[model samples]
Target: MSRPRCERCLRAQDHCLCPLIPHLQSRTRVVVLQHPSERLHALNTARLATLGLVNAELRVGEVFADLDQLLATPGYRPVLLFPGEQAQALVGYAQEGCELPFMLIVPDGTWRKARKLLYLNPLLGELPRVTLGQVLPSRYRLRKAPEAGALSTLEAVVQGLNVLEAPGCFDQLLRPFEALIEGQIRAMGRETFERNHGGR
Candidate 1:
């Protein structure tokens, strides 16, 4: 039989993270485009971010049909949170054309899958790209990051919002994410975690 789960957090009922999740409001609108395969993963931090932020929305799919309308949000400039040669650093990014808040579009998936999302949806590639100025070490100890600056979707969103709004404004969003990481560590046992992850 399947274990019972929390409807909101989707975690096993006994280990629900709902209590740690905080409801935060941000000036920047966050839209997370998640790959469908990751929708049910145990470490789906993108879902946690969506649940914690009032202005955030999560869409699971490869090719988004409604992306046109979604990006048409008024009074906010749309920018993709992705890294590339031309990606502008978001730290102190000057509002050249208009003084509008940013609508941050984040793609949630592995690097290959995220790239596929862009290939399937050409509009995503056309958007202005922004990268975090500082690449902090990830708190997700369960999985090794694919690259040096790679971060979990939740961490990326939190850092992005901090850049757009005030520094540390969205730090609360990490409460549940950190809780989840700790829970995973406990479940795997301290010895195994330390052996595999170097306890870093």
Candidate 2:
């Protein structure tokens, strides 16, 4: 039988990561659009992000209803954090568009699933878009990246917040992410995880 899951963190009881997360607040709100399939995936990271950030929320759906409401919310500019040639560099936006804080709308799923979200919800396609820049290598050892620039949901949030919210946001957010990775590594054993994650 499967181990009992923690009601809060939603992981196995022993692997509960809720207590490790730091409470981070920012003027900018984070909205994660997660596909239903990824809601319970063992390695999903978006849920953990919402746990720590005061202004963050996770919405599970194939097509969203509040695309209009969220974008229209006063005092916040909703922008999609999907990378593309048309996606303005996030740093450029944070610097130039200093008039208002951002509401980062991120899609959490496989590349195909994320694309499906954009297709299903045409309103999302109309939002201003932003992309991360000069990122270090991804530390998501649990899954193979679909492409070179891809990042886990939590990592993307950290990167975006660090650029748009404040400095050190990356380090604060990274604590929980690194803790989760280390816990999984310990569970899998160093030798097996190293072999699987490209170490000798």
* TM per prediction: 0.95, 0.91
RMSD of each: 1.6, 1.9
Highest TM-score model number: 1
The C-alpha local distance difference test score for the whole of candidate 1 amounts to: 0.89
List of clashing residue pairs for candidate 1: none
lDDT (tens digit, per residue) of candidate 1 on 25-137: 87788999999999889988999999999988999999899899999988788999999989998864343334688899999999999999999999999999999988778
Error in Å for residue 32 of model 2: 0.3
Enumerate residue pairs that collide in model 2.
none
Task: Determine which window of 10 residues in candidate 1 has minimal summed lDDT.
Answer: 90-99
- What would the per-residue lDDT of candidate 2 be over residues 1-118, giving only the tens digit for each residue? 9999998779888888877878887778899999999999877689988888989899999988877887798988889999777898777345666778888899999889999999
After best superposition, candidate 2 residue 135: deviation in angstroms? 1.6
Off by over 4 Å in 2: 92-94
